[model samples]
Target: MVPGFGQNKKAVELYKKAVDALGNRQMPQALDLFHQAVERDTGYTEAYVKLGQVYEFMRQPDQAFQIYQRAIGQQPDNPVTSLAYQSVSAYLLKKGNYQSAIPYIERYQQRFTPNSLQWKKVDRLLQTARFGAQAVQNPLAVRPQPLAATVQAFPSQYFPVLTADEQTLVYTVLKPEGDEDLMVSTQKGETWSPPVSISPQINTVNNEGTPTLSADGRTLVFTACQGRTGYGSCDLYISHKTGDTWSDPKNLGPTINTRSWESQPALSADGRRLYFVSDRNGGVGRRDIWCSELGDDGEWKTPYNLKSINTPFDEASPFIHANGLSLFFASEGHMGMGGYDLFVADSTSSGWSNPQNLGYPINTSDDQAALFVSANGARAYYSQEQSASDGKQRSKLYVFELPEPLRQKVRPVSYLKGMVADARTKKPLNATIELIDLATNKLVTRVQSDPQTGQYTAVLPTGGEYALYVVGPGYLFKSLSFDFTKKHEGEGLTMSVPLEPIKPTEGGAPAKETLNNIFFETGRYDLADKSRTELDRLVKFLEVNPDVKIEVSGHTDNQGGVANNLDLSKKRAQAVVDYLAKAGVAPARIKSAGYGETRPVAPNTSEENRKLNRRIEWKIL
Candidate 1:
């Protein structure tokens, strides 16, 4: 008995040593010690957790999940058991097994507080599971059928690039076994002829995989990883086509490339911005999408991280839609259905919002690399290995139509260019404009008119009715609605809006109608239903006038009594003030006030007039 006890104590010490080694990322030593610990005590919970974590880091999720389950079975009430359960649930969710993960996620949520971060994560997981299950049950809820389809696959297969017109096809094809080069094929009549190899200056003995043609087909960017002068194993190179002949390929330079790999370059339609993937330092993850602007000197600006969309995983193969708002890329980090799914995000003034997975069918477990959308935004082109009509199997090109709802939001240009002016004088007025979505009454983006020219341009996402609010220091807040729902094809829009200044009363008192009134609710201290539309208008107004500032004040009717009305009005006013503050409005520009029936717009007599008498107002001052 004494000898057996000594072996057990030694095993416990070895287990502790293994855990410490794992914490320091010493994989080999940790693995050996874990084997010894498990041998001594097969049900050791800590040993299982350490083993699961190590396997997870090694990209063996299946193995990790089994080990985590073993730990869960060993100690059902242990806090670490929940962690193990979550890890396995996350893996299942990633594999589209949301239904199977629901029970585990539900139990985790029931055992923890909803406000805790862990519970919040579980809640999201539950929501996704419920949504996915419903989607499966009602597949019709998901859009059906591609917008269009091609009858035959391309002959010599390679990923194809669509020109701005969406007519010309440029791609790279492997030449024999020794050389790989770019090729171009134009649509002539109903059939496409055999592709012709691009100029000798552009094609080399080295391989080129993906190719991108500029809107005008004047500049071409392609991936040449094994080039002699590459900064890394893979780098993006560009060549310009001047008339018939092509210029020698030039490296994008050190500013865009690092010692780490970078490739798959996509340029905006206007040729002012370049989007590509890089494994450079300071990235949020293994690889991220980055952009470099064309500077005034016509040289590339230093690359800036697209932090809004990137997460701590690989994001690659970016395809900028002809309408610059919609960006399509592949990511392993963002919430996805499977390995490297396709996602699209819009670029707004607030930067890239959370990317949405394209969903099943268009996305699968296999890697979905490059994508090309037609100028009309109706058709999309991708490469896959499905069987074609011919007996011979090939990894050929395929084209499908995008869903109507999604197509409506795909535009060539994202930013709206226009000017705000005084309605009477037609003079430019420095004003604030806000963009609000009519469907959800949410404020989306905001911009300010140039002080010098009173000209303002704001970026607007595709789809929905947007409320435009224009306000100046002493002007009545002007409201207008823009409906981009009819923007069937991607195109740039230009317009000019007029603002009417608020005139002071005969006694020179500030106008009674201030923005504060829009935010105030009823006696309950919560937002009023009538205030919903008005608050949305205010949000849109702020978005349009990004730099404009104002204060919100609340007033009450005399019949409510002085002291009580004073406190009630103050609470109401602060409530409006809080909503705007939470919705990204700067607090310094906003202040709340309570005037207990002192600033009544009308006498408190009938209930109708009394209701109007108690109001809130906003003033630039």
Candidate 2:
């Protein structure tokens, strides 16, 4: 038996009684007997440690920590006090009291054995302590208020998604038997209607969580588990809302959802890219965020892992704001208050930036995840567990205003919505609408018109000019441009398109059309690699009209001397002629000319018109 003190007979007797009470699981009695033993002998190390053990059992961490502190003071070099440093630092660090835990960890390091395996963990805990101390000193005032009873009722509610107009709310509610279903409510001013189940096509006996909606609110994507045809235990599924009814849900296929686990779909504003959580394999973390972009061919490309924002620990629940630059997610990998702290990361052309913790009050020792922010970055919504009147714990959704410093990076965005119809019949037609950034000639997004209604909408992120192409079978592809340069919040544009039917002699007219597809580098007439796509279209057009001859002309803005502009323009026209001749077009049927700055379609004062002035035109001869 370990002696309680050097030579106190009554203290020894009291230690024996305390040990009996502790063995019987009587924590309060054991605590009092141990306290009495320590009073009889102030240097009683055994009694002090036993008192701490009793306090720890009673869930009194502060008293337990004080017991260890007193033991260390009485016997500075004792092994019992040295080991107690681990528990004291743990309690302080877990509560985010980093400054108080710092000295306790340092004292532990001095007396702890170098070969002990716990030193490595102690080092990590110490670093987290230092980080938390600084982060909490200047915390944001985050006051989250529970949503109204109309939206949150019964078993549980979470994962709220708001539309671009902020008039609709879509979310998920957990039912018994571990199943989840999507629910929706409409906003009438500040009050929301009672939420109703979205659609029977999406609800099933299986589990579904983390529902995300497209910018137009026509497409719905979510997670499903234990799927019959899924490669993994869980998979992502999608549904299309047509006319007031939703189509049957379809799995995203092997390109996106693998055999491990996938959930939490976050669709981009443009509806061309998807950000989700997956833990299949070959990722930096156990459960990391991955992305899959829509291809021009109408198929999803292979998903890629987000390397910069993921770590060895688990990461999940990605919510991309309407600004498209800020990303928020839940992570156990990034060091924070404790279990699953919410983090935010800014995006760039190259990749994502390093993640930053959302700070103290917004994040706590308890699990804080499933966060969603509005497009304007003004408000955010999240879910938390609270005790119900029935004494059962239930999760509910809440909303709060975000600090301005956090919303500084929110990008103002504008969207273009329209429908596709036939010019001759004036009837809706199924078509593919593709958007290209004229500044970079890069494909921005590709959305398909609803087969029945021909209605389509896509986000035009930020204020820039974009080319929208509408293509369908047995019809000529119609190209148009929309300028959002002056667009801001509470602003949007609406326009309808009419496609021309491809008749036998329709394009054989002597009328001239600008070759808007051709692209050239600044101050150089050399064609770019992507310009091949446009030239190929011309090749097909010529093949259809074998007997027709055309004259190719080039024009430029009136910026340089006439002599220099004529030379440059002629070179550009001949480049098209050369390409046609190389592609087996008879040399006698093609002619090249340089119009220079003589044909001014639009004034060159503004940059948009200047871009319109620099172009190639073809006329039937």
Candidate 1 at residue 455, lDDT?
A: 59
Per-residue lDDT over 1-621 for candidate 2, one digit per residue giving the tens place of the 0 to 100 score: 377346488998999999999999988889889989989998888788788888899989899989988877787667767657878888887777789988888778776467477776666677777777877887887888888889986599888887766667898898766678888988998888999888978887767778998876778899888644677888998888876789898899989977788899999866678999988888997889998988868689999988999898999899887667788999987888767889999898787888888987888766786788776567888888888899887899899988766756566555556788877677888888777776677667767777778777765666676677777776656666656667554245577877665543554544456677777898789987656656665676677778767898999888877887888889999999999989888889889999888887999898889888888988767
Strongest candidate by TM-score: 2
C-alpha TM-score for every candidate: 0.50, 0.75
The TM-score measured for candidate 2 stands at 0.75
Deviation in angstroms for 49 in model 1? 13
Per-model CA lDDT versus the true structure: 0.70, 0.79
C-alpha RMSD values across all candidates = 18.4, 5.7
